[model samples]
Structure formats: C-alpha cells, structure tokens
Target: MDKAMQKVNERLTPEGKMDVLSKWEVHTLLTASKERFSYEFRACSLAVLNTGSTEDNAKAVLEQYPDFKIEVIQQERGIKLQVSNAPAQAFVDGEMITGIKEHLFSVLRDIVFVGNEIETNPRFDLEKTEDITNAIFHILRNAKALQTEVLPNIAVCWGGHSINRIEYEYTKEVGYQLGLRYLNVCTGCGPGAMKGPMKGANIAHAKQRITDGRYIGITEPGIIAAESPNPIVNELIILPDIEKRLEAFVRMGHGVIVFPGGPGTAEEILYLLGILLHPKNKEVPFPMILTGPKSSEDYFKQIHHFIESTLGFEAQQKYKIIIDDPALVAREMRSMIEDVSDYRRSTSDAYYYNWILHIDKEFQLPFIPSHENMSQLELHKDQETHLLAANLRRAFSGIVAGNVKEEGILSIEENGKFQISGDEEIMTPLDKLLSAFVEQKRMKLPGSEYIPCYEIVKPRNLS
Candidate 1:
C-alpha cells in the first residue's frame, strides 16, 4: 500500500436517512468478511470513495485501490465502519467527508436490510408479483424515499452514462425546462445523461428559488461500481437488482423522459411499453417522452424503427419523440402529468405510488442472464405484445450484464459471447438496431472499443 493510504478506525452516525440497526443485523454485518456482503460493501464503499471521478471503468477503479478495505464494527449503539487503506479523497484533515461517510453507512443499511428482511423474511414472498412489489415498497420506505406530501412532479430521466457533450447539454436543457416548472429529477444515479439533468435542474431550481428540489438516484449492487452514484444525488436508494430499480423509477415518478442511450435505455423503454401494453394498464395514464438534440435524431430514428419492427405500433404509440425542443418536451410532459393526476385522483390511487399500474410477474422476476437462460428466452412474436416485451426485456438485460457487470464480463471471457437466436423477423431488426448502437458509439464510453457481448442469430425456417 502507498504511504498516503491510511487505516482509519472511527464510529460514525447515520446522516439523514439511516440511524439504527438491530443487534442481529449488526452482528451479521460485522462478520460479513467471506460472504457476498463483504464483497458488495467493499465495492460500493470504493465507488463512494471515488465520487467525482470521471473514470467509469469499474475494473480500473478497483485496480487503483486494491488494498483499500472496509469492515463493519459492532457497537452497543448501532455500529461503526473500520476502513483500512482507505481512499484519501473520502477524507479531509483526518475526518471523513460527511456526505461520503453517510453514503457508506447508507450502503450498509440497505444491504443488511435487503439481505435480512426482504430476502429471508417469509412475509415477502418473492415468487409472487404483489409480494415483489411489496418488497420494493418496503425497501424504498426503509430508505425514506417516498414522500406523502409531495405532488406528482418527479421526472425520471433515462439515458446512457456515456454520452457525448451535445447529448449531455441537450439533457441539461430539458432538465432546466422541467425545473422551471418546479419539477424534481430522478435517474439511475450515474454520470453523463443521468448527471446532466440533475446539474441543469440544480441551476434552474436555484434561479426559481426552489430550495427543496429532489435529485433522487436509484441503483442496484451489480452496476453501482461501474456507474457510481453521481455526487449530485441528494437521495440515494439501492434496489436489490436492476429489475426492481426500473420498477421503482416507474412507480415513484409521474413521468419519464428518455434521452439518447444504449441497450440499457432500450431495455427501460421496452419495460415501460410492456406494462402499458397490458390490457389492465392501458387506461392508467403515464407520460413518456423521448427527446434529444438534432445530432441524436438518427439515434432516435433507429430506436423507433427497432420498436416498430419488434413490438409493433402499440409500443411506438406509448411515447412521443421530440427533436431539439426542450421546452416543448417539458410542456408536453407537464400536460400529460395533469392527466395522470386527474386519472389517479378519480381512481383513488396514491399520488406517491402508482398502485394502478399492472406489472406482470415475468417483468418482476429477477433474470439470471446465464448462457442457458439467454439462449432459452422466448423471442417469437406469436405471443401477446406485453409477453414478447417481457422476453425482449430479458434479452436486453442479458446484454447489459455482459457489457459492464463483473459476473457477465467474466462469463464472456470464459464462454466467448452470448448467443441470442429468435424469429428471423425479430432477429433482423434486432441485429440492425444493435449494430446501429455499436456504430454510434452508444454501446460503451467513447475511446473504449466495445467488443460485442452478444451475438444475434436468426432462426431456421422450415419451408
């Protein structure tokens, strides 16, 4: 270890959100050295320590601080963190940065809570759809994410963490428009498109004197290391996985605005479309807008073409695409939110959570994204649109895992590349869409060459 790397032992109190831990939980956390929690805690802690860093490579970040270690220390009053060879960026003049300290404990709080209460507790039946939603609600409630007093103003922004300057600026402009209308922001809690909205919203909120603006970030364990929660996120909630994280965004926000992004953004769009396509959810009003700068017009065109070719007209109708018009995008979203408000009010649904939306069990279940699982997905168009969307969602989920996730990366290294075989009609457009993403440099950050983590194979036709 370097001389500057110092071992710091201190007892810290939880900041705004988390405060106390049960004795059993404290003991479990304190003794989480050889288990998954230790690995998760260390990776998440390192990511928090590496806040404000521009680099997005998780492996590189880990390599930089190979010796940095964090351990849980149990105490009579909750617990404390014992950090060894800790990053100096997280500390100043012998004291840890207050925000970073709070984030560290927040990680501990969520991990323990999820592992013990949600996963192990028989009360939350993970197999059932309602049970899964309940589990998500409990996790968010534990994080104090949902507010009863707040109106329907949270705009969930979805886009690539690795975006160009033009796209990033465009996201900011849209965010500024949203902020001008007193709307708050939520994102995947990463950089690039995610950070851009919050950054722009912050300035606009200040100008409008909106002091209580919420910049919420929702993330899961697998991708947190690669895309560390951006510094602008005042409220952070860690879902158990990507599926729950996506669900949380839709349930909590009144509207969604998608900017130019890669497979992950595509997955989000499909997920939302799948829900909207369900017969029960068709009447439930939820606003979705896809917008970008003029430069990104081609990107949206490709995405639109892909959706039309795959999910058909119904999926395409769920969202409106606006090019280079931030004000109009915000105005449209605001107007649609009013409809959402009126509909929810008439239906007696809670303003904080959209209880009316019907999310199918297929979408709720956690996808393992293994080689066998990826190959076995039902990608034919003969089924219901919503069911097809669920399968398509899983396909993208696998691709997402193969791209940046540690397990997926290792799988690719060992097993070559994941192969996706489906109907020729679907495979053709899917290949073209994925090819466009690769061509436009949306698959990974600029300057990093992307070796495809998936192969799209066409199905055999017996004519």
Candidate 2:
C-alpha cells in the first residue's frame, strides 16, 4: 500500500534561546555516521516530526513513516531543517507550524548537545553522583531552562496519558488553581494529565493577565515517541533518559503534585522518595502531594497501600495524599511554596534550582530494562529504605520500558515477559498494585487490552 504522503520544506530559527549553534555542533548534527548516537538522534527527531499524531505506539508510528527523514543544513546565518514525508498536521498551507518547527529543531539541538557534549564528554563522569547532577544542570542550562533570577514557582505535575475523562478534568482543575496562585506548570509534557494541567493553567494565566507563564516539559527519548510534547509546552527539554528526566523535575520544580498514573508515575514517586529518604536530605523542605478526583480515591488507596507495605511508614509519611479537592491541593501547594521560599532563603540555595538535595549515584545511573537487570534487582529490606526505593524504582522502570519503549517492547517480543523476583513482602504488594493499574486501564490507553509485561515471583521463605 502506498503510504500517506505530505511533504513540506521550511526554514525555522530559534524561538526562545536556540538561535545559533556552534560550528562543530552543526557539523556533528549534519553528519549521519550510522552510529548509535546518530541512530538515536534520528529516532527522536522522527518522533518530534510526528507531533499531534493520535497514535501512541512508537513502533506503529515508525512503521507508518518508514521513509520519513530529516537532515540539518548549515547556512551562512545558522541551521535549517530539511524534511521529507512528514505528518500533515505539522503543516498549514504547506508551511510548518512555527511552534512545531521550533520544537523539531529543539529536539535537534538537545540530541546533538547531549550526544556530543554530555554523553561523550569525559568530564561528565556519569559514574559519580555529583558529576551526573552537574551534567543535568549543564544540559538544562544549555537549553536556557534555568533562570538564575527566577523564584520558586514551577510545579511539576505527574500522571498518565491514559487517564479517564473525570481524572483528566480533575488535573485541569488543580492546574487552574495553581495558575490562579501564579505558579507555573511543568510536566512529563505529554497528553492526559500533563496536557490537562497546561490547558487549565493557560486559561487561568490569561484570566490573571500573566503573559509570561511557563509551561515547561521535560521528557526523554525512550518515552517521547509514545508521549509527544503537547502543544502547550512553551519550553521543551529532552533528557538523555528517564532517570535524568526525573532528576530534572525534582531539581527544577519548587513543588510536586502527582495525579493518577501508572508504572511511570510510580517510578517517578519512588525516584523522589529514594532521594528524599536519604539521611542528608532528611531536612530538605520539598513538598510532595499526591491527589486525584473522588473516583481516583481507590487508585491512591492502592498506591498508598503498596508504599506502606514495601517501603514502610516512613516512605508513606514522606508524602501527603489529598483526594477530591482541587482547591485544597492548590492552596496547600501555595502554602508549601512559601515554605520552600523560606527554606531556600535560610539555606541560601538558588530559587530556580534545588541545590541542597542529595541524590545518590544509584538513582542517577540509567537503569537498562533487560531481563537480567530486572531479575537481579534488590527489592528486600536488607539495605537502606532509600536504596530499596531505588531498586523498586528500577522495577517499575522496567515495567514502563516493557509497556511502551520501542527497544523494551522488542526485547519482550523476543524473550517473552520480564521476570521480577523479590522478597514476597515486596512482590506481593507490587503484584497487587500493578494488577490494579492494569484493571483500571492505567497502564495504556483505554480500549486496548494490556498483557502482563512482567511476571512477579515471590521468594519462598518470605511468603
């Protein structure tokens, strides 16, 4: 069958900060060497061109546009992106949408910078925890995401793209409230919960005559295909991986409000908990609130139970769960923002970034979702609670990979389901928690049956 064809060529300059690229950076981006770096960049660029597409499956999207290609052209002034067989929605009267064009090139800028400067730069030293944090800071700085003089107002919202109508409306309500308080919104930068907040905040921002409100989106390559940057995102930054993306959220946002979500959201919560549970971070004043509509009360119940059972009361105590009240959620976030402001003043930390939180190396390193890696994860209480949170974070990360990421899906197709073995005390609750997510259509978009991507195995003696 002949594929749908929509071709357009356009030249776009930086809208926000990416106005020019260095000569070497432009050269590296243009040269397609068929290396892993180039391949990854190509994949991510394809995903960016596929913005506004309704299809959620990355494999399906790639298959549809198998011949789609992008190339960077160096000009006397700067760089231009050439494309072929791109999506029609990204064009109007055969011209690329200005925002989409900026986003497309932003992908190029970030992919090239991360590939050449951060990943290959030996100075990054990904093995060391501080080095990794520095790398994250530098990437965000390069993207001009960090404002040295800004206040602590960015609120990171976490939830799933597959959420139902009621839950999505709840997210919008919470976002509207946050906007009324002049708090900017940050999200994984996709649809559903992510988009709802921005949408609501846009209205509130307009109402409050706040023209400079920021809707920042932090995403990674692996998940961007499934969750394209929503149209509302004024600033989009692509982290190298999910781990860095989560780290970026915590480091940048003043407060967090988690809505109903799936394994991905669970992974984010665990990542934050792991960091906050650290002894050095015991006094850190980060405010985390998990809230949803009345219908989602049961969802949080299961999540609360799982956290209590696996990570114990201390982990559970680290976050507050507010249900059925968007006003209260926003009010609490506002109050906490003041508290955050006071704490940062006392500690003399930057308002734009959290400099005092101590993130361990275990949480910074990328967790490859291979079967061996998943099976070898330490999920017992033999270590520190924060460390166990890191391992559990990895477990959910594997589940997220299996469900959506292209490579993880391909791995599962070839080797069957990922095997997750751990102490029964942990595995039992995990199984229950994941099972609830599956039943509630939280794992994937509704109307699609979700096959178990992982097998939960309980240790004999612990059971």
Candidate 3:
C-alpha cells in the first residue's frame, strides 16, 4: 500500500490451468525473456498483467517497465512465476487478481507449447500453406479454443481502438443483440470496438441467465503489448503472429461484423476480403457484415470506395453494409449463421472451426514490415484480385507497425518513414483512404498528435 510497493514482487502460482509442465518445457521457456531470443514471451506476459492499460505504444510500455522481470521456477508438482516489478494494478491486498493471473498463465501456457511443440517440432513446415493452417489449428486446439458440440454462433467483431464514443456505443448495442440471440462474441481483444461488444454481451448474457457465455479474445505477441486484452475477455489465446491471429478469427467465428476503424481495422477488412475473394472459397457461405452508427455512413462509404477501387466490384459483393441498426445486424448475422451451419453440416466441416475456407499461403506467411519490404511491395493491379488485396493488407500493416508497434516505431525513428509505392490506380485511392484516417485522428488515441508513418508514392503511369 506504499509507493515502493507500487511495483509488485510476487511468486504467483497458476490459478486453474497451466499448473504443471515438463522439465523440457520449462527449460525451453527459460530463454523466453532473453534479449537475443526476442522479448515476445516477456512482452506478452506483461500485456496480460497490464490489462487496464490505455496506451497503444508498445515501445512506451516496454520502456515504462524496464526493470520488470519474470522467471520460471520449476517445482515437483508444478511451476511458479517469480515476477518482480510487475504493475501494481494487477494486484490487490498484496495478491494478484484472479483474471490477470489466469491471463498471465495463459500467456505462459502458449509460450511453452509453441516453443517446445509447434516451432521446434519439424512437422510444421511453416512455408507450406496447409502446414501453416494445421499449425494454427494445433495451437488453438492446444489452447482449448475449439470446442466440441458447439454450434455456429461466434461473431468476430473488427474495429479500431481509437474510435469515437458513438462508434463504441454502436458496437456495444450490436454485441447486446448478438448475446440476446444466444451468440457469443470474439474480437482482437483490444479496446474501442473490440471491448465495447464484449462489454455489451456480458450484460445481455447475464439478463438471459446464460452462465457459460464465452467472450473470446484472440491476439498475437507483436500487437498484444500495444492492445492488451479487455477485462470482458474470459478466454484469451495468443497466436505466434498477426497473420495467424487473423486466421484464428475467421476460423473460429461463424460470422464477422466490422465496425468503423483505422489502419489496423482496414488491414483486417482487406485480409478477410482477400480470402473470400479467392475462387476456391466462392462456394463457402461465410457471413460478413460491415455496420456502424448513422454518423459513420460516410466512413463506410469511404471504405467501400477504397475496396471497390482496389479489389474491384467483385470484392464489394462479399459483404453487406448496414448502417445504424444493431438489431438488424444481429438478426442478419443470426439468420446467416443458419446458412453457415447448414453449409458446414452439408460439407461435414466442424461447426466450431471453418475448415472449408481456403486461405492462400500469401495470407498465411508473416509479413515483416521493414523499410525494404514495405518499399518493394507489388501494389499494382496487374496481378490477381486476391493477391492485390494481400499486398494492400501488408501496406496497411506496415503503416500500423510504424504507428504504434515497438519495432515499427524504432524503424521509423532510425530510418525515417516507410516508403510505399505502386501504380496510380491503387496508390491514389490508397492515399485518400489513409489521409482520411489521419484527418479523423484514428491513427492514435485522442490528445495524441498523429503523424504519418509511411509516404504514399503515387505513380503517374502504370509503372
């Protein structure tokens, strides 16, 4: 209860799960926080405990807790986390809060499993397309995210963390409707639109006397520090990267509802459209809807225009745009989920996981948004529509990295902004859309001065 105790030092045990681990798993996890090995485990663990954080800068969070450290202490029955300099908010009355502790263990559980089983195990040749997906399935299965005997009712919500009050309220209303219909909520598990829906669904589930409601949050190591899980999330699963995280959303949810957002949301929109646009997935009855408050109609128009201009009209046919009607959104999704269920049943696919959808290897591969890679992206229109979407998704992803991610922020600071260039047909609309996000102050939280992280090089000819 003193200023010195603000940074907690505690030996914490697992709450419900992850209480036991093998000697090999513990040894492999011991290198987690080492600098040469990467701060992925350390950073993700911090984010799990730093649940109520409002800052979206990963570098700032790391620097804010430079003295923080955690180690795995092996025991006969189980293992314990020797945590020092952890955020005090995660603890009350000198004991770590139950949810945060559980989240922390979930982080540990994933790190150990992924390091020892998936990554080190040669069975998953990540370069192969199907292997990547199978690896994702194994990761989710290991985390117990894919349930048995569950119907098609999970709705994956996508939006920005830096949205306005109106948009946030709209997400909550939509979530409430979904919960009233016995549907669960899945999200990127950050703030703004992601948090709103789960918060709304929690209240509705209580009203309906639903005790086993699931508020699932799927994230990855790269973005978790910047966008920590909201308190409403009862189930949290951390994949290896953003690409896997995106796939997890589509694979787990029966339907997707998109709320208004910035570049990160734009990235997600493009990723989904790219997959659904694939000829192989044309027969798949995946339900996708884009909706927001009436005030956000122009925003939707802007996004729609960008999509049409880039991926062509074919991409526009993939989803519906419903404005200002949460009930209607829920009803449409609930009805469409019946189609999803039927399709899955007919195809003999599992109701909890979408095995029929085809995601190209391009979407599965991790895109490192370095300066050279960002500049070399083939953002022209001569390629396949889905391929074009994949590039655009990467472009926005790079911009997102430079905006808030630690590595991207450091790259920007060291080498200046990333340079994104392509044909005028793609660059012009792309520039317009990005500029609008900057103008609306969607790139960063309110009261923070937004800066453009990448320069759009508009081509004069088809070069």
Q: What local lDDT does model 1 show for residue 153?
A: 88
What are the per-residue Cα lDDT tens digits for candidate 3 across 317-427? 999999999999999999999999999999999998888899999999999999999999998889999999999999999999999888999999999989999889899
User: Over the stretch 222-339, how does candidate 1's per-residue lDDT look in tens digits?
Assistant: 8887788887888878888888999999999999999999999999999999999999997889999999999999999999998999899988999999999999998998888888
- So what's the TM-score on candidate 1? 0.95
Best by lDDT: 3
**What value does the lDDT take at residue 292 in candidate 1?**
98
Taking all chains together, each candidate's TM-score versus the true structure is: 0.95, 0.96, 0.97
In model 3, which range of ten residues has the least summed lDDT? 29-38
Which stretches in model 1 have alpha-carbon errors above 4 Å?
1-11, 21-25, 31-36
Comparing 2 with 3 on TM-score, the higher-scoring candidate is 3
lDDT of each: 0.85, 0.86, 0.89
Question: Over the stretch 67-177, how does candidate 2's per-residue lDDT look in tens digits?
Answer: 777766677766676777777778888787777777786787677756567867788898898888899899888878898777789889999989999999999999999
Highest-scoring model, TM-score: 3
Note the clash tally of each candidate: 0, 0, 0
Q: Sorted by TM-score, highest first, which candidate order results?
A: 3, 2, 1
Model 3 global lDDT (CA atoms, 0 to 1):
0.89
Better of 1 and 2 by TM-score: 2
Give the C-alpha miss distance for residue 298 in model 2, angstroms: 0.6
Residue-level error in angstroms, candidate 3, position 138: 0.8
